[model samples]
Target: MSDQKASTRRIVVGVDGSGPSKAALQWAARQAELAGGVVEAVTAWEYPSFYGWGPAGFDFGDNAGAVLTQAIDEALGPDRRGEVRQVVVCGNPAAALLDASRGAELLVVGSRGHGGFTEALLGSVVQHVVQHAECPVVVIRGPAEATRG
Candidate 1:
């Protein structure tokens, strides 16, 4: 049996079920493989407000966890699934992603997202995470088709 200590360097990746996020997952997987580390695939979600609703009405208590799990499965597939752990948090996407990145060795995210124009500026989750994460951040844009399978 090998005696090498398993690396503790964690990689946090933000995924929103978009093409660019998928590309980021792929890139993060390669990095995890190289570093002998695991990837934390995170997805932050918030429910649309209902008029004058109470906390119970607006609560997304367990839904976020399910969403994050589904996203990780869709992004990583069976082959790379074992290398990733899914994380879900409530609140703003950028804030959640950045908070999750606190102790990470590297935080990876896509350059764009489902949020249309908001993502055009620094409002992009990737941009915000890169700017605020305590660790190194990597933004992955979808590769040219020539590089894709």
Candidate 2:
């Protein structure tokens, strides 16, 4: 409804089934709960293009959706009860997050996701969104054990 949409703040978060991402999701959910907003969990993916040829039999979008669901279940527990909104986009991660963050109150992402980096900070997607997001951005830095899911 228009009333719900107008009253609810929209907090967008990037999820990739990784530790940092899960941490981001948890933070985003808590922020949304405190602010009476909805967390828009976004997951983006792209088909592998090898030499201009794509895979013959693969549903990348479906797989991405499944992964998103699992990540949500893992991060937020099983009974969300519609506390979060799930969004799956088929494109570049930064682009998807930027597009989803339009008119959003806040954009949240992990310091790094699914990357082999415990020493360095700021993954490419986080950097891009932080530099280019229209809304405010929050980068959650988890513990070293956050490398695992």
Q: Which ranges in model 2 have alpha carbons more than 4 Å from their true place?
A: 1-7, 51-56, 113-120
- What TM-score would every model get versus the actual structure? 0.72, 0.85
lDDT for each residue of candidate 1 in 23-138, tens digit (9 for 90 to 100): 88888988998887888888888766763565654456466676666666676776663368777776788998888777778999876433445444433566667767888988
Error at 44, model 2, angstroms = 0.4
Cα lDDT of model 2 by residue, 42-126, tens digit: 9999867662466666688898999999999998898764479889998999999999888789999987445465456677899
Whole-model Cα lDDT per candidate? 0.72, 0.86
RMSD, model 1, all Cα superposed?
6.3
